[model samples]
Target: MARTRPRPRPVATGCLMGRLRGNPWAILCVLSLAYFMAQLDISVLTVAVPDITRDLHTSFDRVAWALGSYVLALAVTLITAGRLGDLYGRRRVFRAGVVLFTLSSLVAGLTTTVDQLIAARALQGLGAALLIPQTMALLVEAFPVARRGTALGVRGTVGAAAAVVGPLVSGLLVTVLDWRWVFFVNVPVGTALLLATVLVPDDDRAPGPARLDVVGTLLVSVSLFCFAFAVSQGERYGWRGWFWGLVALSAVAFAVFLRQQRRRQSGDPLVPFELFRDRDYALMNVVSVCVSLAFMGLVLVLSVFFQSVLAFSALKAGLAIVPAALCSMVFGTVAGRLSDRLPAKYLLLAGTGLTVAGMLWTAAGMHEGADWPRFVAPLSVIGVGNAFLFTPLAAVGLRGLRPELAGAASGVLVTTLQIGSMIGTALSGALLGGGAGSGPTAASSRSAMVLFAVVAALAAPACAASSRTPRAGGTGDRAPDEDAGRAAAGRSPCREPRPSGPGRGQGGVPR
Candidate 1:
């Protein structure tokens, strides 16, 4: 007897999802919510930190592992997962990630000990790593060059919403219910997202032939794990010899990774180093890292200041920042529309300048006690600034990347943001000494603001540097006559091709 071939479930699922094919906006809705879940998980857990420590009878130092494990695991595996998506299929891997993340959330919520929670968190991170980049890659493939900015802006807004929701929801849950509810909350959201995902057609793999470089993947994964672990744990462990050693290993392993990638003359390399040759792309990455560094530190300080200085309850503190979140949502759409008309350089400059102002304003509030009403203005300003910065930056990163490289580029871009977040959090914690209520907390917040401002200020020069690129790549400045494959006029890979004749296989219709 002939062996039976397994019929894929998504074939049926895809038919169910086929209604969403021409509706790119609806597809984006699914992607945005999924991305929001991944982003929200990190901040939500932070709110429950104290409760987790007390309930599990774990030391404050040990419970830190819950956060660290997740961050490290997410960072280390992103690149490999991205390439694998290119090699196999994004739809399958992304669905797998959703299942893993939801199950892990269940495990995390049920755990009685810190170790169990930490292990479950690590699995959650791995799931997150697999899905996040695929979201961006699918975004790039799904949207046309003309409207990509608007979609990216929507994604930016979703991220901002995650920040706003994470604290508020977590605070309420930890206060009114058990700390485990933070994990439990994901169950419903993840289920809804998974169902929505099944209703959308799984994106086809990248157009060109691709192959996975196993050695390259291993090297980079090891390097990233070492680097991410070192940064996440450095402050807690006191920068001891082991800490420095891990950092050193990260550097060495990364060097080996580069060598391995360079040696792959035929196969698909984990990272196409050639992408950096585009000046606009390189500068965008630089600005992304710096902006993320400042944003992370600024957010950490404000959250601490509101509760510690103003004596507001956790829920109140979270609600106080609502103005910023609202502003970001309203203006982010405006900025996305503007991106299609304005040069990206100007928006980047405006964003950084606004961010600096917001940071200074928040720092000012920390002086002589918290200025309750005063902080709202700056928070709103930061929201608008973030809207301007992120979407255009995403457009810049996607510029000139062929469809085949979308996943890899998305991975690299998000990885830069992750590293910056880790560094900024650690640096801000160091600056604040005891985080929120120390004798120098107010003064430290000011100093940290200045440090972040200086970093934000640096993006101006990089923005200037970016303008030197040929038409600035796709910064709403590319010439019409440039290579069609790399510009706005290029065909999107996600669109189904037209059938050439009657009864053709394209749409599977008989004449």
Candidate 2:
């Protein structure tokens, strides 16, 4: 009898190359559109707040719920959604999120009352939370590691551009048509994107046997909710009693969550402790949180300053951010490309330095009578610095993660970002005190600038930490080796070991 010939398996390189040649740009477009819609929704409504308030017959403070509620919901559920995507399938969750977001946009557009709009916005946030983590996970699964930096750069650029365009577009719509149009516009665009997403092939990788950690999720959600609420409402409620009480409670909840997570003997933890075992991943989280805090705080302060202090209209204020946004988009791509070739730590450090310098300059020069051009120069510098930080920091955080942990890591990364934004906005708002002041306008500007400078300064240590982090697959990368050795020795890598099964992918896609 003759021996049978064995069938050859397709090479990963050939498979990936074939996919790229066939429909590479399609996925990028879909992902970019999703990201753009999510970011645009967040910033676009800012300029329309006054109009929304007028139409809803609500006060400015009540109108803030239009933004705050969405953010609060997003911050609370972001991690849970990410983990859920990892557990089930990213594509499924992402598609569902897009549909939900589209429906919510319609609800918001048709809303007649303040309560209706707020509920719609909260729904929108929930959809966004589901959408964001899965988007990154899809990108990671679709793109090779060598190209991830570029992909992430494109994502960052689109997001930043959307932020810049949001107000300008919203101002035009509100001025010419109605504030509701801002939400209405998303309907057509989102519908098209949803149809397009359906054509994108799903990566139905096998999932691990790890079950969801319901208690951990609840604890973390409560903790983050309390923390975000405390930060956001601290000024209104008074920092001494209710604010501090919530803060303390949040801390305790966090502690309890950590303890419970550590105590788990089986099932998937809401956040795998092993993910943070990597120094780079841990440091990246810190850096991401700090950078987000600084960026959000600066944007909030500058938006108000540009309109109130510099006497710019809403459209002009939106346009003023254009240069910075453009600079960030340009620099972000450059930095991302450089990240593939150069040491990420140095790039991150340089970016942080530039950001710090820009913040300091802004702080020093922000006088009531300062020229707009002078302010633009510093703000543009800050944008450049942010661009520098965006891709490298992301690459650093996710550099060496295996395919299975991708979703969780991305979830944690985004969660940190949301937390940072909440904290930054809260801190800045608390200091600004509802943007009202009978004191010298310069004094108010100075106080905001100082707050920004302090946040920027915090990035320096994160930069240093990045420098010390070990790269994946490098000799110095001890965490992976340790985990591997533990697995080899029949010990579980997680704090609480469950029955062995497949691991999560590096991009947060199940495998």
Per-prediction CA RMSD (Å): 5.9, 8.0
Reference-based TM-score, model 1: 0.87
lDDT of 2 at 370: 66
**What TM-score, over all chains together, does every model reach?**
0.87, 0.85
Residue lDDT tens for model 1, 250-292: 9999998888888874556888886676677778789878988
TM-score of 2: 0.85
Q: Please, what is the whole-model Cα lDDT of each candidate in the order they appear?
A: 0.75, 0.75
Model 2, runs deviating above 4 Å: 1-24, 205-208, 433-440, 467-470, 473-511
**Candidate 1: C-alpha RMSD after superposition:** 5.9
Candidate 2 global CA lDDT score = 0.75
